[model samples]
Target: PGGVGRQLLQKPTPAPAQHPPVRYPLTGEPRILFWAQNFSVVQGSKWVDLTSQTFGAEASVDVSGSSWSSNDSRLVLKYANVLGSPLTATFHMTSRWFPVSGRDWFQLNRLELATPSARPTVFNASQVTAPSNYSWHCAHLSSLPGFGAGLRGHGPSPSWGVLLQDVQVPAGTPGFSPGSGRGSGREGLGGVLAGACLDEPFPPP
Candidate 1:
């Protein structure tokens, strides 16, 4: 009986090894970074002035140590609150087991938009923050907001993300105090009068 059982089971074949994909000529990860805007809860329709000093604020997420990859066909990147953190998401991929470096065609963006809302994982704060007072002052900002993937370049060619990496925050930018946009004393704050009381280490919100 033991001999007959051995014959019933056959050896299985192994899968082929996958290799790293080559980037498009002059094309690669978007390499773009974005900072979400946070602001105070003021009454009435208050136009968030980008010119004057914003009392306290920051971009959506820290853009330092950030990069992108188009190779993530089925990848679910999370918008992390911390710099250099992986973009995490409840990826609704058809499968998880992929050959290493295999081009898995998964819809990561669709998975994110499929849900009602996206929850904050790291940079969760009770108060609000704002973007930079000056439009061009941001580390990776050009002129407008990005689309699904990121900032599209000019013409039919279309541009991807082109923000600077490893950007550091100054006293007046945003997301300094409270680690969630409460530092009012920083310099370029656009008209958001956070005058005086800057000697303290942390913010006073």
Candidate 2:
């Protein structure tokens, strides 16, 4: 039989209303992660309405979570847009996760994580999980440089556009949506998404 082809057809684990928490380096903030292969929408608005902000899916998702340590982080502010003139429009965001006990937002979250220019990495339960207790499946997207993605790095890419399998949003925080696009990869070590560029705006449509 076609083992590889058959495996592809298999069903996915019904994600939990609350996906398990993952702790990124430095900041031990907790974020909910998932493995979304693809996502699309067929709302009423197309280009004219959206460009003028007339109406449609102007949604947002607040990602906040706590890790085993003190670190906490919030990321990816999403919204629906028609890719108007100004290419950049808070399409998505990434922020830093702090290392503390209480709660706080990260500083170096960066802008690419949420933007379409962002990378396509994978996150598998085998990679980010703790050595002691691993429960969820592993997922990876593009890779960022400097931080230390380590031995687990899957060498640059995958066969298709890697969806936002799962994120590390806080348990209670909600999230936003920017529709869809092809993501890029960060060529560094442990360079996860942080939220400085996440809130900025780019070109004009």
Query: Pick by TM-score: which candidate is best?
Result: 2
Relative to the true structure, how large is the alpha-carbon lDDT of every model?
0.24, 0.26
Error of 2 at 187 (Å): 30
Which candidate has the top score in lDDT? 2
TM-score of 1: 0.18
Off by over 4 Å in 1: 1-34, 38-188, 192-205
Per-residue alpha-carbon lDDT of model 1 for 1-205, expressed as tens digits? 9988887886767532222211111133322212213211111233222211211233232223222343332222223421222333221222122466453322212222111232322211111112222111122222124311222333332111222211112212221332112334224342332221111222332
Model 1 CA lDDT for position 94? 27
Instruction: Please estimate how well model 2 matches the true structure, expressed as its whole-model Cα lDDT.
Output: 0.26
Cα lDDT tens digits, model 2, 1-205, are 6999999999997733322222222133323222222222111333122211311233233323212222433333233443322222111212333355333332222222123554432233222222111111212222323222211323454212212222221222222122111132222111333311121111121
Candidate 2, residue 101: Cα displacement in angstroms equals: 26
